[model samples]
Target: MGPKGPKVIHVGYTPAHVEQVFFPHAEVVGDLGLSLARLARAG
Candidate 1:
């Protein structure tokens, strides 16, 4: 990938929505959870 190319990244958040508000990217492919008590589920 080039400097301007799109990249895939992995983010693990016990409270999912926390970082989501700061992430400007519309494409999110990862677990969804409000808390760590629940299991890790993909989006």
Candidate 2:
């Protein structure tokens, strides 16, 4: 969706909330990142 590939976005949640829904890759970004990922974006 951007200049690279599909755009990845975060719906605005606390780091804890994001973690509870998804895995963490950067304490917070990990969840948002993986949510939009097509591969192993969490690792």
Candidate 3:
């Protein structure tokens, strides 16, 4: 478990793989952006 909750399993893939898998979803843009923003804030 992570700080907030249970962590997601990435399953046999890297960043590029997951990005490609979610490419067709419109929410991907905002989701990825939020993820990057969170990382930036954490750093």
Candidate 4:
């Protein structure tokens, strides 16, 4: 074991995509959600 570098967290992208997005220097995190949602209130 040795010193570590920056910590990364992926939202919803594949490993390959994540690597590309982070320039192949980031730790990949699992998907967060499947679908997005929006809420509205009546006045």
Candidate 5:
């Protein structure tokens, strides 16, 4: 976790694998570009 809390977006085929390796509360997505774009727009 960072100063502002968890800010990681793990993009992968297996969400379980990401949770095990990276962050358990990470925002797992199938499409990296689309997800990032959406976040960018929202922010």
Candidate 6:
């Protein structure tokens, strides 16, 4: 992996503290099913 990599999408129950420390710029989606559906459609 280089500077540019696949987009990181974090779904469900991600607290702000954890998110800030770990998933900085990740796309945080609350609904797991909805997010999966969207990803499937996009693919």
Top model by TM-score, which number? 5
Given candidate 5, what's the lDDT at residue 27? Answer: 51
Give the top-scoring candidate (lDDT): 5
Residue-wise C-alpha lDDT for candidate 3, range 1-43, written one tens digit per residue: 3345544533222342445233322122236566667657977
- In terms of lDDT, the poorest run of 10 residues in model 1 is 34-43
lDDT of 1 at 31: 55
Query: Model 1, range 20-40, lDDT digits (tens) per residue?
Result: 334323333345354323433
lDDT of 6 by residue, 1-43 (tens): 2236544555665533443335434655567788778779988
User: lDDT, candidate 3, residue 5?
Assistant: 52
Greater lDDT among 3 and 5 belongs to 5
lDDT of 3 at 3: 43
TM-score of 5: 0.44
- Flag the better candidate by lDDT, 1 or 2: 2
Q: Which is the winner by lDDT between candidate 3 and candidate 6?
A: 6
Q: TM-scores for all candidates? A: 0.19, 0.19, 0.31, 0.23, 0.44, 0.43
Report lDDT per candidate: 0.39, 0.43, 0.42, 0.39, 0.61, 0.57
Candidate 6 structure lDDT: 0.57
Ranking by lDDT: 5, 6, 2, 3, 1, 4
Error of 1 at 18 (Å): 30
**TM-score of model 2 (CA atoms):** 0.19
* Clash pairs (backbone) in predicted model 1: none
* lDDT of model 5 at position 35: 72
Q: Give the Å error, residue 31, model 1.
A: 16
